[model samples]
Target: MTNKKIAVVISSIFIFIMVISCSTSNDNPSETPVIPAVLNTVGLIRNDAGALNDGYVLFAPIGSNTTYLIDKCGKQVKTWASSYKPGQSCYLLSDGSLLRPGNTNNTTFNAGGKGGIIEKIDWNGNVTWSYTISDALQCQHHDVKALPNGNILVIAWESKTNTEAIAQGRNPNLVPTTVWSEQIIEIKPTGTSGGTIVWEWHLWDHLVQDFDASKANFNTVASSSKLININYNASATNQDWIHLNSIDYNASLDQILVSSHSFNEVWIIDHSTTTAQAKSHAGGNSGNGGDLLYRWGNSLAYNTGTTTQLFGQHNAYWIESGFPFENQIMIFNNGNGRTGGNYSTIEIIKPPVSGYNYTQTLPYLPATTSWNYNYGNPNSLYAQNISGAQQLSNGNVLFCNGPAGIFTEINSSGTTVWQYINPVSTSGVLKQGVTAAQNSVFRSTFYPKTYSGFTGHTLISGSTIEDVNLISTSCK
Candidate 1:
């Protein structure tokens, strides 16, 4: 054979081998597309093979009046409009309605998470029910929970004058001019603009303090584990004393979980008690009435331990019945003043429970978390305030870094599988490539495609909410 012919045959053989290799690589499902490391790109950032692909994310930005539902591809599937900005949190109910709180900008309860109204907007954008709890001395704020029986539980701040605070055994020096306490109200929607408070629990009634012996509720602070110590937060001059940021209900247990940002603890109270029984310390299923059945995170709040486990935590709730760590409590442990440095962690703990009451322990139970997740370098997940975590059905965890408006989903092994950044900001929807600023979201929720809420609704995917799109199409 001629030397030229031999050389041409060798070249052809090499080209054919290269083409086959490329085709095989393309067919492999494990291969992930090369996502550009864009500095400030919004929408979907990462969507790997392990991420749950058949679910949508729901979020309401704190600065905007619009709540959104986006698919795994970061495309808008649905949206609900509100007249006022989010008080802080929103949720998509199973009945194709948006349950959200509207920030009425109440001057009386002029503090963070100041929401005065709760609205139930149907799938077609009509306000079917509206209720307001903001008044001179009390205003609903932060989070709300929709119960299985159609009633809504709201967190509100009730104010007390310094004279009233002093009369209640509060330290005169520690009391602000107006001391703000917390309460939970159960509202049954009576009509389009009316709600009847069927049941309520007042924190003011379950207080104990060692500051004043002459006062009626005075007692040894540490021993009164079931009661709140009015003087625990010595440095708190602000009227917003017990800033309860989140609330959750466990139908099976008939209990309520509330996260107190000020005391840095999650407290569970028996909801089986009537309004009359709740005012006293006895006569509930747990025989503890409205008193705390279980409280964890900060042992020092009740003066049981020297150190604390939670720091400015948010979104403390029980894992649903069928999830991986079912019935366990999960918290977004926002490490605001963590010992080493500021960082964040998602922790799940098995509370020591005996029927309706927690097994009485010095500092609660489960000395440490049953499971926890953080970046190898923990600071990567830090969100100083307003964040949340949810346990999905497939054993994966979805969480939001609220202040930065970032969402991440990690598998049981703590490997990040999916991520997205909020495109909506205070001004409006931001352009794709712009740095995400002022786009803080209170929280984000993951709903499976089979969610009952989407049953009859048309969830056609539209373009990204942001003005321009750069990454989602290519990356996905």
Candidate 2:
């Protein structure tokens, strides 16, 4: 053969081999995508407004196994390493321990926010206590609250069969083979990995379905929001009926506030009730047992009216005492499914609780919000899901735009005093607008400068602020 012909043949062979190798690599399901470290932050320190409360923010990226504690200047002061990725939430306790919900290999329900394991890790990243509360029937998910009595409050799904749901007036077509309703269980740790289910409240226990009058719990839900409408979310076959995302306890009021994403409402239930009383309609401080003593945000959830109060809200909790708002409620209104498109708002409202039931005549509280913060720009402040709002001791509000990975602190007058864009990106290739979708954080919480969690630890900032690439993003 001629030398030129031989050289051409060799080149063809090499190109063929390269194509085959590339194709094989692309077909491998085990190949992990290289996550990029993209820092997008203005880190603008605007203490001039006096809204800047010197504190540390803690959060874990949705799929990342490591949780971070960063200072106001956007520096990683501390971190906790975990073997399993945090399913959704992580909280730093006052005694230097971290209470975190994590995902397990178990695939019982395979639903969103299915966190099977709750672990208590110390300051040095050692697992001090761990509990597994998931099984084929039910599993913990989303948010967990640390109670005052050392017991932990967890949110789980109570699985119901199609027949069971139909019996409760659920439309058969909407009821898949299995349906999941929200439940709250207060667990008292008896051992390292096991706990006693000290107190429990199930959404299934308090339901009213006008769909089938023949079924049990059938009622014409008039003014009472206590009975959940089983057919309210029957558009699709998805069984996550009431996707309860957050749970907050008011120790003074002895009530538990839960935020339901699917229902677009926040319900206040009496925490002072016994387990048996909670399952019944009468027997608590408010004489409403496990039933919702007060509900707001979405009035249509009850038969009251069709006024859209809160459009898929989150992090509904009571403000601490001594603050200006004091006993008012603070919430992150994830303004999804709104008339004007996607926009978010931070709102504070005063609930009129004469006793167990809400005394307000209006469908929802506050003919107008007592105070609120919206960027004025429709798309300025929006997170479709997994965001939160916290009221700081200094009367400032810390808002977490979870999907956007942006955390901001704003003054009472709605002035942004500080801002930080999370630098971590799930996709190695950081596209400007889609970074939020790729890399999301469930929530970010602020701890005061004097938080006891930092007592014994030597804190140092291991993070550097990098200029963020601004993205023109729109919300659905």
Candidate 3:
């Protein structure tokens, strides 16, 4: 699922709720429709018969508020709830639910039973189960992920007590500065006491304020204004350093790999350990910017001049098993460098030394093999952030564009095999999980009342042939 760009002070979940219904796009003057012409690589994709370019892809438009499960031809199989505050994340589950965080027009949402619950719905949009995480407890972010063990994972922020919050860098002067701590939560499955906390990880505990003030490498003005210390809430803190934004599980290793937008590092949480199994973190510590096991890109080495790196957050995934290039890790560097960088593209990297026992420094993304998409204007597609790189069955990369609201299938020579844009209705694409419709859109961000749309989804296999037709889908 895609993550929204929040400045990091407000509870992310609150921001998640806020953006869904934001009419900011109204402020964006409509520009001429730029029909996607073939990039130089389009010719190569035309020849790659394997790229999946069949059927239709549907999405919830940013302001439309309705989830339209459509076909490649733009036929809407279903449309639901013309009311969900339009946001950028949503997911399809095994139980036929469209998962997404939503906002309510009513300020008293929970009492009205119209907002804040992780609602599961049927194809008809009937609520099956709604898990209302206490808003006071969480500032939810861009997406929600379901765990294989029967729970869900959220990129949420936990509020701190007034006193304890102050020590963690909060400015007492700012009344409602909740002192948000970015975290990963594993919600227990049903049949248990509400839900069990399988595991949890917090960012503040492991940070080191090593950003040398003398050499602060920021482009923004040296604001003469007294900055808030929760600046742990600062952009780089959210982009290259600490707050973990995206997560994926390696069920094989019983480990979790998380992408910290602020720290620009990916970590593997070994769940095999029976210890509290919650909140403990290893690897790059926010202190001293020490590399936990291995580190690529940049770190908090301000003294060395190689300060904060990997500008912002995106996808860092392991090569799925059974692929031609198995075992190698693939990451999509969305190019919002923490401080600054040149190109924005997908980079497929291999470990300098590949084996078992993946460590922090295992796969160093090549400074070169990385691919960038320059949409003509020397500096175009200004907001091309957040991309997911998948090693497709056809050996192509199914690249999702978070800002431009498009997904493209590209071949090795950096060519676009096939492409689809998010309808003005749908804006960003996040961590896509399981897609059914051929040339389908898989979203990891699932919320309640999501079953509003979703009639029958078509299934496409390798961008070449039509595969299975799922009658009715369900989630556990």
Assess every candidate by TM-score: 0.92, 0.84, 0.60
lDDT of each: 0.88, 0.77, 0.44
Evaluation by TM-score, superior candidate among 2 and 3: 2
TM for candidate 3 is 0.60
Q: Distance from true position, residue 287, model 3, in Å?
A: 20
Candidate 2 lDDT over 1-476, as tens digits, reads 99999999999999776544432423332343221223233332222336454678898877678888877645567878888778678999988999999988557668667788999999988998888878988888988999988999999988888898899998777778888888899999766787889999999899888879788788886645677898886654787778888888999878999999888888899989999999999997888888888788877778787787688888888988988698889999998986677888888888887755677474756567788888365437778888898888778888888887778788777777666666656643233334344557788999877888788778876533333333211100
Quality of model 2 by C-alpha lDDT = 0.77
Give stretches of model 3 more than 4 Å off: 1-50, 54-58, 72-83, 86-88, 103-116, 161-178, 191-194, 208-243, 280-296, 301-309, 337-343, 351-381, 384-389, 426-476
lDDT of 3 at 97: 71
Better of 1 and 2 by TM-score: 1
Candidate 2: list runs displaced more than 4 Å: 1-53, 355-357, 360-364, 375-379, 427-437, 463-476
Which candidate achieves the best TM-score against the true structure?
1
Where does candidate 1 clash, by residue pair?
A: none
The alpha-carbon deviation from the true structure for residue 432 of candidate 3, after best TM-score superposition, in angstroms, is: 27
- C-alpha positional error of residue 186 in candidate 2 after TM-score superposition, expressed in Å: 0.4
Candidate 3, run of 10 with poorest lDDT: 467-476
